[model samples]
Every structure is written in structure tokens, then in C-alpha cells.
Target chain A: MRRLHHWPLDPASRAARFALAEKGLDVDLEEARPWLRAEPLFRLNPAGGLPVLEDNGATIAEIGPVLEYLEDAYPGQPLMPRGAVERAEVRRLIGWFDVKYNGEVNAYLLHEKLEKRAQSLGAPDPQAIRDGRDHLRWHLDYLAGLLDERDGLAGPRFTLADIIGAAHLSCADYLGDLPFDEFPAVKTWYSRIKCRPAFRGLLADRLPGLPPAKHYDDLDF
Target chain B: MRRLHHWPLDPASRAARFALAEKGLDVDLEEARPWLRAEPLFRLNPAGGLPVLEDNGATIAEIGPVLEYLEDAYPGQPLMPRGAVERAEVRRLIGWFDVKYNGEVNAYLLHEKLEKRAQSLGAPDPQAIRDGRDHLRWHLDYLAGLLDERDGLAGPRFTLADIIGAAHLSCADYLGDLPFDEFPAVKTWYSRIKCRPAFRGLLADRLPGLPPAKHYDDLDF
Candidate 1:
């Protein structure tokens, strides 16, 4: 049996979960938070974060490896496309959302709005929130532009790229930060991906004292 | 023919260069500075960064995809080992250096000691410098502990893990930030990786008005 150590609302964890669900793999779940710096989590992953997977006597840590592991180990249902160049595009978009979009949007909203509250670090900085919200509009516009042309972020078929994009935007959506109305294509694209059974579990996560947005978890939204 | 656009001192670029060289692939070079935010660079990579690779009508941008592209397409001289779990460890180490190590050490030193001067972004914060330096000692020590146990950063054979670790530490080494004497195993590991023919070009790189640390290019430092 495979086991996954994860934290709800963590985009990396969500992405891993999405990958596993897409593969139709069954994994026993264990909750872990990086901020807590649990020693056992560190033992499993010296980098010390959640989304660590233990399968077949191997411990796979870090989100990138976790997804790649699933794709390679479970070659039954491929989240990645067939060609090498196409795979690069998918991976590039993964980097785009995981790093660039995360830096621009999630780092500000999630760290300030949710993480700080959980860790008792401090209240959200108004300036940071403003910057994040401003960046989110631009990102959503970009997403809409892409969805206008392609069926998915990387191409005509759904890939891990869409999974990562939705995973990140989901966190912002939970906080009522995503302005989907302004970007109709992205909203439509997101709604299609949202209804996927792989995404249902993540949409249902709730942080204590902070409820999700009104439209969050609404299939029609 | 492959064309790689890169900057000399960027850690991600260094990792890409190292990956290409390890694969023994020939690549035409174009120097790019992302801080300048050049339009052409943005066109090649929407994320707008260096180390963008163009190969046979395919534009692979971002370090992760670029490396994976080489691994998948070339497969001539394998930098990554066979087996699913082993590859995960290699990838995890790549994430360790690219994210954790870069955040703790290189980001401060690279921004303060090099980038700020290059971009005329005022001066480096003394506190950032101090925190980065303090973290460097801890990182080097941790690296030494790993080297003491394993042949390379991940295991017996060299992988992207060692390349990324060396690539990031090479930048820190450029700033004279690493205290090698306190971490012999890491220093030994560095000396071994540093002497490879793949690393020759990177060691020869020099920026105007900013020289590398005294031992930056030493084969047996």
C-alpha cells in the first residue's frame, strides 16, 4: 500500500493528491505541516515538507518528484502527454504556476491570510494583499487568454499543468481572492477542471475560523 | 543544434548548463539578464528568465523542464540513474538546492553581493547578508553530513542533485560566503565535482567590476 503525507490547502500537497487521484491510485493519508517541522516528516524528507509519498519501500519527497514518480511508476493512466517537447511545455506551465504564480499570488494571500493566522505570526499586511490581488487579475487574464486557444493550459488535452494551475488558484479561491468574473475563459476552464473527481477532495478542505468563499465548492461556480 | 540562453551567475542557469554539459550536448550560447526584463526573453519564456533552451523547433524554458528535456530527448549519456525511486531522490535533491538552499543562502548573497551591484538596486541589507552567511554555515555542515554518508548528494552515482548543489554552492563560493574548513566532507565533494570538464566553462565566467572569490576556480581548493 502507498501512503502520502500531506497538509490540506498546501498547493504542493493538492497537486500530488490530484496526480494520485488522476492515476486512480489508492494512498493512505497522513497530515503533515512544514511549519511545524515535525521530526518524522524530516526523517522521511530532509527538506522537511509535506506531500512525501512512501511506496514500495521508497520514499518520494518534494512535489516535482512526487508527480514524476506517479507518472513513471504508474504508467497506466498518463497525466503527461506522449512527446518530449509536449512534456516540456507541460512541465514549464507547472513551473509557471508552482513558482511564478505562487510568488505573485499565493505567497502573499496564503502566507498572510491563512498561514500567519495558523502559526500566530501576525495579521495580513494590507500592502502585500493589495499587491497579490493586483497580480491575480493579471494572472487570471493570462489564464483566460490561454484557455481561449487551447482546451487545456499546455495543449488540447488535460495534463499536470492544469492540475497545478487549479491547485494554486483553488487556494486563492478559498480565500475569496480570485476574480473569475473578469476572465470568463479561465472561469469556464476552471469550472470544467473543478468538476473532476480528482479535485473534489481539495475543494472540500476547510481551515479553522476561516470559511471558504461563497462560490467555493459550488460545481457551477 | 541546441541553443541555450543563460546568465553566468544565475544558479538555475548554472544548473541547466551543468545538466547540458553532463549530457555532453553541444549548445550555442546567448547571455540573458532577467532583471533587465528583456522583451525577447519574455517571448521565449513567459516566466521571463534565463536558461531557456531552443532545440529542433522546441523552446524548453525553465530549469526543471530544460533538464528533463535533455534527459528525455538526448538519453545519450544519462545524468539521471535508472529506476523510479532513485530518480525521486535525485529530483528531491534538486528541489533541496533550487528552493531550500537557494532561499537560505544564495538568494541573499547573489542578490546582495552581485545582482544589486549589477542592477544598481541600492546596497545589500546587512541583516540579509548576516542571515545568509549564518545559514551558509548550517547548510555547508548539513552538506558535509550528507557527503559523509553518501558518495554524492543523492547516492553512489552523480546526478542532477550534485549538479544543483555544486551549482548553488559555486555561487556562494563566488561570494566567499562558504566556510569550507568547517565542513571537510562537503569541501571534498566540491573539489571532486568542481574538477569535472563539464564545470570548466562556468568556472571561467567573470562579471565586469566583480571578481569571483579567490578560490572560486581552484581545482583543489
Candidate 2:
């Protein structure tokens, strides 16, 4: 069995877990605090981040590597599309959510709403909260726009691109950050994703004091 | 020929350029200002980012997707290793450099040293410069440690991992930000990479007003 080191509310960790569950791989979970730089976590991943997977002797850290490793090592359920061009689209959207969305939205929203609490930091910055909300509107619009071209964010069928988008957005959603009414297409697409059996785990994860949005776990909203 | 829209000094663009050169792919380079989010650049990539690749009808944005497309489509000059674990290691290092190292070091150093100059954003923050230098020491040490286990950064064979690393570090090197003497192993490893014919184009790249460091383009620095 493999062992995964991750934090529950973290988007990367959620993606890794969801990917693992979607693949039907059994793994024991261990919580890790990357900021603490605890001896074991540091050694397991010199990069000092979450979603680190230790299978036998191989320790894979970083969501990019872990996601690819799952796709490559376990081909049971193909998260990546067949054609090179299609796969590039999936990975491109993955980058969009992981890099662009995370930077613009979650970096501010999650940090303010969640990580700050864990680190015992005081109140979230009003300006950063405003920035997060502002950036999120652009992302929601982009996601909704992408839906106009295809059934999913990246393509006709679901892929890791969708998985990653949901994971990242779920964080903001958990903080009641996303305005679903403004992005009807994204909301519809997300409703499909949120209802997946693999996503149940993500929906269940909650921070002690930070209650999720009223419709966060609801199957239909 | 494929076309690449990029900003020369950006590490991600440099990585894409170096990856193309390593793979013997000929691409006509068109410089784009991502910050400006000009009409054409935004049309190519609505995310408003650089290192976007247009091949045939497919437009690939972001270095992450571009590198993978090159490896998957053009197998002639393979930049990735054969095994799953090895490929994961290579990707891991790419993330380490692109995400961790870039955020901690280059995001500060490069933005301050280069992008700020381009945007006419006034002077670089001295505190940011100091912090970038401070963080770079740890990365150099980490790179030096990586070289201890394998001849190259990721493994015995040179791969995209090396390309991304060299592409990223070259930014600070041009700015005279790195202390090569302290990490002999990394310095030696970089020396080998810098001497590659593929790297010549990067070495030759010089911003108009910003002449590179004393030994920036030197093979035996």
C-alpha cells in the first residue's frame, strides 16, 4: 500500500486524493504541515510541500509529478486523453487552474480564509479578500466561457483538467468565495463534477471553524 | 515552422526555447508582452501569459504544456527519460524550479532586476533583492546536493530537468545574483549545461540596456 502525506483543505492534496480515489488505488493518509518543516515531511519531500506520495521506496512530491505519476504508473482509468494534442489541452487547463487560478484567486482567498487560521495568523486582510474575490470573477467567467466550446472545461469528456479545476475552486467555494449565480455554465459543469463519487471525499473535508458554503456539499443547487 | 510568443528574459519562456533547441525543433520566435496583455497575445492565450506555442492550428500556452507536447509529439529528440519513476523525477525537478525556486527566488530577483525595468516600474525593492539572495542560497545548496547523487540534476542522463534548471538560474546569473563559488557541484553541473550548443542562443540573449554579468556568457565561468 502507498502512503500519502497531505493536508485536507489543500487543493493540491485534494486533487491528489481525488485522483488516487478515481484510480481505485488504496493508500493510507497522513497529515503533514509543510510550514512546520517537520523532520520527516522535510526528508520525504525536500521541496517541503503537500500531496507527497510514498509508494514502496519512491517518494513523489508536488502535484504535477504526483498527477503524472498516477496517470503513467496506473493506466487503469486514463485521466489524460489519448491524442497528444488533446492531452496538451488537458495539461494546459491544469496549468491554468493550478498556476493561474491558484495565483490569482486561492493564493489570496485560501491563504486568508484557511492557511492563516492554521498558522495562528490573525484576521484576513480586507484588501486581499477583495482581490481574491475580484480575480475569481475573471476565472469563473473564463471557465464558463470554456464550457461553451466543450462539455467539460478542457474537452468533450471529463479529464484531469476538470478534476484540478474543481479541486482549486472547491477551496474558494468552501470559503463561500465563489458566486455561482454569476457563472451559470461553470455552476452547471461544477455540479456535474461535484456529484462524482470520487469528489465525495473532498466535499466531506472541512476545517474545524470554517464552515463550508450551504450548497458546497449539496448534490443539486 | 512552429511559432513561439515569448518574453526573452522570462524563465518559463527560456525553458520553452531551450526545450525546443534541445529537441532540434525550429520555431520562429515572436516576442510578446504578457504584462501588457496586448490584443494578439491575449487572443493567443486568454490567460495573458508568455511562452505560448502555435504549431499548425493548435496553440499551446504555458511552458508546462509546451514542453510535454514537444516530448510527446516529437519523439526524435527525447528530453524525458524512459522509465515512469525517472520521468516523475524530471517533472518533479521542473516543478521545483518552476514553482518553488521561481516563487522564492526568481519571482523576486527577476521581477525586480528585469521585468520592473521593462514595465518602467521604478527601482527594484532592496528588501526583495535581499530576500531573493537569501532564498537562492538554499536553492544552490539543494542543487549542489542533487548533483551529489547523480551526474546531472535529475539523474545520470541530462533531461528537461536540466533545461528548466539552467533556464531558470541563467536569469539570476545574468543579474549577477548567484554565488557560483559556494556550490562547486552545482557550478560544475551548470558549466556542462551552459557549454551545450543548445544553450548558445540563451547565452547570446542580451537585453538592450542591461548588459549581462561579467562572466554571464562565458563557458568556463
Candidate 3:
């Protein structure tokens, strides 16, 4: 029995879900709120991180390890390229989204828009939101540039890089923050990936009282 | 014909150096200041991150990919375990140090202590430093607890987890932080890893105006 503990809107958790679905692995999804730091979550992962994968008796926590575990243990559908250079490039994109994008955009945007509601941390700071948007523009431009030349973010084939990029961008789109029209290349690229079977689970997500944007799930938007 | 572009004190850079040396891959170390956002650095890695490795004709950037590339290209003296479970465990620790530890401790400690000096930012915030120290203590306690059962961080074998932990801790120690005396087990573990030939290059690193702690490089401190 394989089970994945994740939050619906969490980028890392979303990435795990996309990867699992792409690999054709059947998994029981358990929603874990990372901000809560619940006891069960801690028991599974000492660090209290979301997107933990439990395969039979073995436990794999955090996005990095979970993704790697799937690739190693499953290996049915490869998420990474075989060549060392190509693999390194894919990993670089993973780092870019996981670290750079998260720090620059999500830390402020998600924290204010999403986490603040969960934690009852009061109103969002406009300045911080503006800063996040500004940074997001820069990131989008970079992505647009990459998509202009390649079929996917890393290379020709759709890899984990696409999953991670979409995971993050989907979250931002949910908040109606992503200016997709401005970066048509990225928008076109996303449209192709968004149409995949793996993305269905993400589009169905609704955060109760906090509804997503009108075009959040619309494939044609 | 291989060269590694790195900043001496950066934990990720230090980890790359340790891994390269451990793999017995001779690399020409070229120090690149991340803060400068140098044109050449950006040309190699669009992300402008430090510790970019140029191996002959190929360019690999960031610690995560760099380490993976090394493991893939050079399999001897493996930094990761063979089993999927063990490899996941090692990666979890890497994320722990890279993301968790870096955010909780280095964001404040290194920023105030190191980056402030580099960027000509004003005096260090006492509160931030205190918070970093408090977080560091908690992390140290966790490490001590882990060491009580296992010989190394991931298991009995010395993996990249040890290298990453030492890299971050060594930076803190250089800044005259890291209360090694408080956590005897962590201290003992550091003592063992610090004596290795891979660590010698890191120990010898010295910034022009800034000298390390009194026992920063001392093997038996």
C-alpha cells in the first residue's frame, strides 16, 4: 500500500502528486497541513514537512527525496533524463523552482494570501505582495525565454522540471497572480502540460471559503 | 580540465569541494562572489548561483545537481547509499540542512555576520542573531539525538549528509557561532569528519579582512 501525505495547494506536495500520477502509480492521498505541525505528521517526518510518501513500511519525506524515491523504486516511467548533463539540467531547474522561485515569490505571496488565513496572521502586507509580484514577473520572463527554444523547461521531453514549474505556477494561478498573457511562450507551454492527465488532481482543488481565480481550472484561459 | 567556480565560505560551495575531493576528481577552484552577480557567472548559470562546476565542456550549477552529477559521472567513493530507502534518508538530511537549517539559522546568522560585511549593510541585528542561535541549538539537539543511534547521519556510512552538515556547521563555527561544547555528540561527530583530507581545503579558507574563530580550523578543539 502506497500513501502520500500532502496539502492540496502546497507546491512541493503538488509536485509529488504530479510525479506519482505521471508514473501510473496508485497512491492514497492524505491531506497534511504543514503550518499546523501535527503530531502524526511529525511522527512520519521528524522535520514536519509536507508531501511525505509512505510505501508499505518505508517512509519518504520532503519533495526532493520523495521524487528521487519514486524514480529509483518505481522507474517504470522516467521523470529524469539518462545523460549526466541532461540530468544535471533537470536538477538545476528543480533547484530553481524549489529554492529561488519559492524564496523570491511564494515566501511572500503564499504566506500572505494563503498561510496568513490558516494561521489567522492578520491582513496581507501590500508592499510584500507588490515585491512578490515584481519578482514573479522576472521569473516568468526567464521561463518564457526558456520555453521559446525548448519543448519543455529542461529539454525536449516533459520531465520533473515541468512538473515542478507547473506545481508552483498552478499555485500562483490559483491566487490569480500569474500574468499568463504577458508571457505567451510560458502560457503555451503550460497549456500543453496542463492538458496532461496528471494535472487533473490539481485543477479540482478548492480551498473551501478561499476560492481560486475564475480561470483557475479553465484549460482555454 | 575540470574547474569549480565557488565562494569559499558558502556551505553549498564547500559541499561541492568536499564531494569532488572525495570522488578523487581534481578540480581547479575558482572563487565567484554571488553578491556581485558577475556577468561571467550569469553566462554559465542563468540563475546566478555560486558553486557552478564546469567539467570540460559541460557546465553544472548549484549544489543539488552538482552533487548528483558527481555521483553519476564518478561512482567511486559513493556519497549516497545504494538502497532506495537509504538514499532517500540521505536526501532528507540534505534538504534538512539546505532548506530548513539554511532558513532558520544561516538566513539570520550568516546574513548579519557575513553578507552584511560583503554588501556593506549596517550593523547586525541582535534579535535576529539571537533567534538564529536559538534555532541552531534546537537543530544541534536534533543532530545529537540522531548521532546517539547511528554512526553517521544517514546510517553507519559517511554520506553527503555528513558533508552538508559539516559545511553549514563549519560556516557557523567560522562566524564564532555553533556551541559545540553544549552538544558533545555533534562535536565528536564533527571531529571525525573534520580530520578527513576532503575537509582540509575548507579549513584553509580565509577572507582578506575577516579571520575565522580561534579554533575554527583546529582538529581537536
Q: What's the TM for chain B in candidate 2?
A: 0.97
Tens-digit per-residue lDDT, B1-221, candidate 2: 69999888999999999999999888899988888868988888877787899998899987888889989989887888987788889988887887789889988899898889999999999999999999999899988888999987889998989999999999999999989999999899989999899999999998999999999999988
What TM-score would chain A of each candidate receive against the reference chain A?
0.96, 0.96, 0.97
Error of 3 at A60 (Å): 1.3
Question: How would you encode candidate 3's per-residue C-alpha lDDT over A1-221 as one tens digit per residue?
Answer: 99999988899999999999999998999988878888999999998988899997999998888888888998888988899899999989988988899999999899889999889999999999999999999999999888888999999898989999999999999999999999999999989888999899899999999999999999988
Q: Is candidate 1 or candidate 3 better by TM-score?
A: 3
* Runs off by more than 4 Å, candidate 3: A125-127
- Per-residue lDDT over B1-221 for candidate 3, one digit per residue giving the tens place of the 0 to 100 score: 89999988899999999999889889999988889988999999988987899997999998888988999888889898999999999989988988889899999899998899889999999999999999999999999999999989989999989988999999999989989999999999999999999899899999889999999999989
Tens-place lDDT per residue, model 2, A39-148, is 89888888778889988788898888889999989988889888778988988887777778888988899888788889999999999999999999988988888999
Ranking by lDDT: 3, 2, 1
DockQ by candidate, in order: 0.82, 0.79, 0.81
**Residue A15 error, candidate 1, Å:** 1.4
Ranking by DockQ: 1, 3, 2
Question: Stretches of candidate 1 above 4 Å error?
Answer: A122-127, B122-127
Q: What lDDT would candidate 3 get against the real structure? A: 0.92
Q: lDDT by residue for model 1 over B48-134, one digit each (tens)?
A: 886899999889998878888888998887778888888888888877876788788878888888889889999899999998999
